[model samples]
Target chain A: MISTTNESDPNPNESTLVEASPRRAWYRVDDFLAMGLAALIIVTATVSALLVRPPNIPQLVQDHQTSKVRLQQLDPSAESFSADRKKIIKQQAEIESSIATMPLKGWLVRPGEWKDDPRAAFVKSDKSIATPLLATFGVLLTLFAAVSFVQGQSAWRFALGFCGVFGLALFSYVLAGQEVVKHYNLEYALWAVLLGLLISNTIGTPKWLSQATRTEFYIKTGLVLLGAEVLFNKLLALGLPGVFVAWVVTPIVLVSTYLFGQYVLRIPSKSLNMVISADMSVCGVSAAVATAAACRAKKEELSLAIGLSLIFTVAMMVVQPFIVRASGMGEVIGGAWMGGTIDSTGAVAAAGELVGSVAKDVAATVKMIQNILIGVIAFAVAIYWVSFVEPRDDGSKPSVMEIWHRFPKFTLGFLLVSLILSVIQSQGIEGKSLVSSIVDGTTKSVREWMFCLAFVSIGLESNFREYRKMLASGKPVILYVCGQTLNLILSFLMAWLMFSKVFPNAASELLAK
Target chain B: MRFINTGVLKFACACAVVVAVWMLVLPVVGDFPSVRQRIEGNRAAGINPTAVFYTDHPAMADIERSIAAKVNAPTGSFWQFSARRPK
Candidate 1:
C-alpha cells in the first residue's frame, strides 16, 4: 500500500515555520551551514596549497638528473636507446612497487601516493602545518553546527555531541578506505552507513546527537559542488563511438527498466525503481544519490539501491576481466564492455588495466563519457517526477508554477556549476591542466568531505526496520538484477558494435603507440 | 505571483550571487598561478603531483599489478563465489 500522494510532501510539516505561515525562510539554516562549510573547505585548501611550501636542494638535483637521463633514453634513432628505455621503465616500476608498501599516512596530503602521476600538478605539504589545519577545520565545523543546529536550545552539549558522532563517522570512513578495504571495493559510503547503523540501533542514538544529523542538507551541498566535476567537454574525448556506447545504450536501459518495474513487476515504490534503474544503467552510488534526491526518495530506498550496487559492482569488477580473457576479447572491446557496465569509475579503471594498458585507457575514457550523463539524467528525472508522477496521482495537471515549486532547487545549482565550468574550459582562459588542478585541489576534495558528512548523517538517522520493510517485497532486488542483466547485454552489444564494427580503424589508431 | 513566497525568491537570489561570484569573479581576480608554481616547485623537488583521475597517478601501476596478481593467478578465481562452492 504505497501512496504516490506522499511524493508531493515527503517531509511534510518538518519546516520550522508555522503551518499557515506565508513567509518561508529564504534559505533553511541547514542550507546556510552546509554552504558555509563547502566555502570554507575550498578557500582553505586552495589558499594553503597556493601559499605553503619548503625548498629541498638535494631532491631537486636528483630529479633534474633523472629527467636529463630520461630525455636521452627517449631518443629513438640512438642505438641501445630501446634497451635503455626498458631498463628505466623497469626501475621506475620497482620504485613504485616499494612505495606501495609504505603505511598510510594520518594526514590526507598524499604526496607519496601521487608523486609520479603526470596528469595534474601536485604540491608537497609542510607537515608542520597539518596540526593547525586539522584543528581549524574541527573548530569551524563544530561552531557551525552549534550556530545552525543548537542556536540557544541545548548550548555546548548539542555542539559537542555532534562533534563526537561526526568524528566517529569520519573514523569509520578512514578505516573503510584502508588499502585492504579499498582492494575489496568496500567504499566509504557503505562503511559510513554501517557504522552509523551499528551505533544507532544498538546503543540508541542520543537525542542531542540526532539533532546534528542533517542528511539532506549535507548531500545537497555536495551535489552542487559535484556539478563542477561533471564537465561536459570530457564527453567528446573518445569521439562518436564512445558516445554511442555510453549515451545510447544508457537511456535505453534506464527507460526500459523503469517501464518494466512499473508495468510488469508492479513495484510499489517508484523512487526505489528509478534509483535502481539509474544505478544499474548509468553509474552507482552517485546516480542513486542524484536520482533519489530528484524524486525525493526515502533514505531507506537510497540505502537499498546503494547496497545492491556495491555487491554487484564488486562481483562485476573481478568477473568481467576474467570473462574477457577466457573469451579472447581484445583490450579495447573488453575495456569498453567493462567500462559501460561496471558501476564505479575507479573499479572500472582497475579492471580495465588488469586486462592491459590499452584496455585501461579505453575503459577510463568510456567511463568519463558515461559520467557526463549524470547531469542530464538528474535534470530529466527531476522534471519527469514533478510534471508527471506527483500530478497524475493527485488527479490534476500541474501548472508551470506548481512544477517549478516542486522542482529540487539544488539541481539548479548542480547544472549551473557544470554549465559555468564547461564554459570556462571551452573559453580556454587557462590551460585544461589548470582547470583540472583547481577542481582536484579544491572542489573535488570538498565534495568528498561533504558526501562523507551526508552519509554519516544518513546512517545516524536511518532505521534498519525501514530497510527491512522496503526489502520485504523483494521487487527492488529483482528489479536491480533484471535491469543489470539488460545493462550488461545492451552495453556489450553497443560497445562491440561501435568499437569493433563501426570504428575499427579509429579503435586501432587510438590503441597504436 | 500572489502565491509566490519571498523566502524562495531570496534563496534563488542567494544562489545566483554565489554562482556568479564563484564562476565569473574568482577566475578574474584570484591567483591560480600561485598554486601552479607551488606544484611545479614540488615536482622539481622530486615529489609527484596529484592527479584527478586514478589512472593518471603512478598508483596506476600498483592497481594493475595488485589486481593482476589477484585476478590472473591460476588459483582462486571468480568461480569460488559460485552457487556451488569449489572443493
Candidate 2:
C-alpha cells in the first residue's frame, strides 16, 4: 500500500521540521519551485538558440528540399540517383551543423572516457576539464542555493553539503567513463547509487550533508528538462509499423505485468510493483523515475526498481544480439524486438547495431517512440492513483479538488515543455534544427547532471537494512524477471507482425532512408 | 579503533570488489574478439552505446533528417503521373 502521509520531505534523512509540515500547501510550493527553475533553463536555452541561428539556414533548407525532389524523380537503381541521394544527405547534414548553438555548449561538460589512469577522464588533448567542471558546479550551486534560500533553509549549509554530493556525482561519472565499464553499458546511475549507499551505510551520511540530498527535487527538475527532448514528431520515424510495435504492444505488457504482480505475485507495495512494471516495459530508469514520482512511491522502492533494471539491462545488452544472430532473425524484426524489450535506450541501440544498420535505425526509432509514452503513462498513473489507489479515510469518493491537490505538478511542466518544443520543431526543417541544437548543445548536459545528482542523493538516503527487508521476499526480483519475459515474447511477436506480415515494405523503406 | 569497525571493513571489501570487477574482469571480457569489434565499431561510427535518448546518439540526427526529407518530398513518382486519369 502507498503511504498517504503528505509530508514534504520524501527523504527520511531530511530534517524533522520538514516532515512536520504534512500539508498539501507545502508540496505545491516545493514542487512549483523545482518546475519553475527547469522552465527558466529551457526557455533561456531555446531563446538563445533562436537569436543566434545563422541567417543562411533557411536558404540551405530550401536547397535541401529541391534536392530531395530531384532525387525522387530519378530511378533508385541508377548511378545519378545514388549521387543525388548522397548530395542530399550531405546538404542536410550541412544545414543541421550550421545552426548556431546555445552559449552553454562548452561550459557544461562531464568527465570524458578514460582507460587505466583515472586522470585521463579529466584531460583531453592537453585540455583540462577543470574550467568547465567548476563552471557547471558554480551554476548548479547557485541555482540550488537560491531554491534552498527560498525554502527558508540556510544556504550556507546546503551549499557545503552540495559540494560533497557534487563530488560524489563527479566520481560516479569517472567510474562510468572507464573504458571497460562504459563498453559494458554500465551507466553512471548505477555507480552513483552504489557510492551513495556505501557512504550512507558505512560511514553514515552526515546530518549536515542531508540538507543537500533532495532526491525528488533534483529528479523532478531533471524530468522537466527531459520534456524538451520528447518531440512528438519523432514518433513517425518508422511510420505505422514502429507505432504498432512500440505504442500498441508496450501498454499491454505494462498493464498485464502490473496485473500479474498485483494478483499473482501479490506484491504488498503497489507503487513498487508499478514502478518495476513500467520501467521494465517502458524505457528503464527514466520511466521508473516518472512513474515513481506520479504514484508517490517511497525512495527505497524507486532505488530497488532501478537496481533491478541496471542488472538486467547489462545482461540483455550482451545476450540479446547473439540470440538474434543465432536464430537468423531478420535485422528489422530483430531490431524492433530489441528496441521494444531492452529497458535502456542506449542498450537498445547497442544490441540493434550488433544485428545490422537497419536494425540500429529501427531499434533507436522504436525506443524513441516508446520513450514518448513516459508522459502519457505518468499522467494516467497519477489520475488512477488519485482516484482508485489512494484510500479515502472518510470512505467517500474522492473529489476533483482532492485529486488536483495530490497530483505531481512537475508532470504538467514536463508535458507542457514537450508540447511547446514539439510545436517549435514542427515549424519547418529550420525549426527542427534549432530545437535539436538547443537540446544537444546545452539542456541535455544539464539534465544529465541533474539526474546524476538525484541518483547520488538516492544512494545517500538509502539504507542496506531497508533493502534487506525489501528484497527478503524476492518478489520484486521475481516480478521483474516475469515482466521482462513477457515483454520479450510479446515484443517479438508484435515486431514480426508489423514488420514482416502487416507492412512487408516497411524495413526496406526505412533502409532506403 | 573507530575506523576499523565492521561497517568500515564491509565498505572496504565492497569497494575492492567493485574495483576488481571494473579493472580486471571487465577489461579481460572486453578484449574478446566479438566484444572488441563491436565496441571499436561503435566508437569509430561515433555511436555511444551508453546514450540515454535518441538525441544523445549522433546517428539519430541523420536518420531524422532522412525521414524529414522523405516526408516533405513530392508525393508521387514522375512516371505515375496521368495514369488512369478521367477522360
Candidate 3:
C-alpha cells in the first residue's frame, strides 16, 4: 500500500514511500494499554491518598468502646492494668482520636511531632501555600512541557536537564511555605536572571554540553537528595511478614515492569521506556531517575515518561485506600496489602492508617523497606548502564566507557550522604535532637519540594503549542497501559497471597500474639 | 502591547530572579519552619499547609483507633464486612 507521490516537490528522501513495520502495528496495541495504565495509576493514587489516611476522632471513640473487653480478656497475665496507666492511656488515645477528628488548619512545620509541641499556630487556612505551590509548579511545568514538546520533535540527545536554578527556586518556595525558607537572603533578588532565561527561551543548552554534563548533574542531584528520605531503620517495625511482602512483591513489580517495557511494545528506546515503567511500578519519579540513568534515556523521553507516571500516581493516591475498605478485607491484611502495593510511602502510610494502626504499621514498614531498595536499584542501574545497557556496536549496547562518558557524578555524593548517615545512625550514640532533626529535615521537605520544583521546570520546558504538532501514534502509551494492568493484577495476587492466604496465619499472629 | 509584553516579561524575570536566589539558599532553608513542629506545638499531627485545608475530615482516626486496638493481635488475613445503606 506504500505509494510514492508526485504530490510534493521535495528531495528524494522526502518522497520515498515507507511501509509500516511490525513494531509500528504493535504500537497500536499499546494505545489500548495506555488507558489501562492510566486507570491503575489513578486507582492506586486515589485510594492511597484519600481512603487510608491518619486516624480521625469519631472512629477512636467507637474503637475505645468496642475493643476494650477483647483486648483485656486475651492478655490476662500481662501488666496489671494500673488505674493510672489505664486512665492515662485512655486519655492519650482519646486525645489523639480527638485531634484526628478535629478540623484544625495550618501545618505545624517544626522539628518535632505536632503532639509534642505547644506553640504551633493556625493560619488563614485558605490553602495559600498549597495553591500557590501547586500553581507555581503547574505554570512552570506547562512551560517545560511546551518547550520539550517542540525540541522533542527532532532532538536526538539521550541526556536532558531543566533549568536547575529554577528547580532550586521552586524547591525553596515550597520549603518557605513550610517555613523551611525565610526572608534571610537578599541573594534571592538575583535569581531574576535565571527566571529571565526561562522566559526568554534563549538558553541554547548546547546539546553536547547539556547531554554530556548538566542533565547528568540534574538527575544525580535529585537522586542523592532523595536518598535522605529512605531511612532503613523505620522498616524494622513491620517484622518478618512485612519484610516478605516488600522484598518479594517489590522486586516482582520492578522485574515485571522492565520485562513488559522491553518485550511487549518492542520499545526501541529501552532506557526511556525502562525509566517510565520503573517509576510507575516502583516509587514514582524517583524510580524514574535511577532507571533513566541506567538506561541512558533522552531527557525529553524521561520527562514524558515521568509526566505520564505522575498523572497516574497522583490519581491512585486517593483511590486505593477506599478500594481496600470496600473490599471488606481484614485490617491487617488490608494494611499489608496496601503498603506493599501502593507506590508513594506517605500516601501508602496514610492509606494503611485509614484501615487502622495495624495497616499503618505494615504499610509504612513495607514502604520503608521498598524505599531502601532505591539505593540498591540506583547503584545497580548505574553499574548496568556502565557495563551493559549503553554498549551499542551491532547487537551490543553502549559500553562502560560510553556510560562513564554519560554517568552523572553527583549520585556519588548521594551515596556518600546515605553511607555517612547510615553509619552515623549505626554508631548507637544517636541523640534525640540529631535524630529528630535528621528525620524531620528529610521527611518534611525533600520529596514534596523536589517534585514541585522539578514539575515546574518540566512545565517551563514543555510548550502546549508545539505538543499539538506531533503525529497521533497511540502505541507506546498503550503499552504502558498494558504494563500497568499486569502490575495491578500482580499486586493484587501478591497481596492476597501474602495477606489473605500464605502468611495470613503469621500476619494474624504478628498482629495478635 | 509592547509594554504589556514587557511587563509580563519583567514579572517573569522577577520570578525567575527570586527563584534563582532562593535556589542558592534552598539547602539552608530546608523546611525552615517545619510542619511537624507546628503539629507538635499544636498537639495535633498532620498539620502541613495542605492538610490544614481539610480541617473537617478526621477520617483516618476511626481506622487508627481500631488498628491500635488489635494491630498486634492475630486476625484473619482477609477481612469480610457487609454494609447497608445508613438510614
What's the residue-level lDDT of A181 in candidate 2? 75
lDDT of 2 by residue, A1-513 (tens): 122222333444541101211354453465787789988887777788777877777687787677666666756666575467667777768766776456777788999887666789998668998999999999999999898777766677778889999999999999998877776778888889889999989877877677788887888888888899888887877677778889998999999999999999999989999999999999998898888888878778887888899889999987998999999887888989999999988888888887877777778878989998898898899789878898889888889988787677778888998898899888877777778777887889999999899889989988888889979999999999999999999999988877666666555555563
Query: Where does the lowest 10-residue lDDT sum fall in candidate 3 chain B?
Result: B47-56
Whole-model alpha-carbon lDDT for candidate 3:
0.44
Count of clashes, each model: 3, 0, 101
Minimum summed lDDT over a 10-residue window in model 2 chain A is located at: A15-24
**For candidate 3, the TM-score of chain A alone relative to the native chain A:** 0.58
What is the iRMSD in Å for candidate 1? 17.6
Tens digits of per-residue lDDT, candidate 3, A1-513, equal: 112222221111111011111132332221222222222322332333333334453565455545454454544235653343345346545543332221111221212111111122111342234444344444334433332333332122211233343445543333333332212111111122223234424332233222212233234434554555455553444445556666676667677767776776666666666676676666555666556655555545555565565445445545766777888766676777666655544455555555655666555555556666777677776666556655556866665556655554444545655665565444432221123234332322333333333334333333333223211354446755766676667666766665545544545543552
True contacts recovered per prediction:
0.01, 0.33, 0.03
Candidate 3 DockQ category? Answer: incorrect
For candidate 3, lDDT tens digit of each residue in B1-87? 775677577656766775564455453444446533422322232312122001111232233333344333333222322122122
Candidates 1 and 3, the one with greater TM-score: 1
Model 2 ranges off by over 4 Å: A1-28, A124-126, A511-513, B1-4, B16-29, B66-87
Model 1, position B11: C-alpha lDDT score: 44
lDDT of 1 by residue, A276-322 (tens): 89988887878788888788777777777888988888788779989
- Give all TM-scores, in the order shown: 0.70, 0.91, 0.54
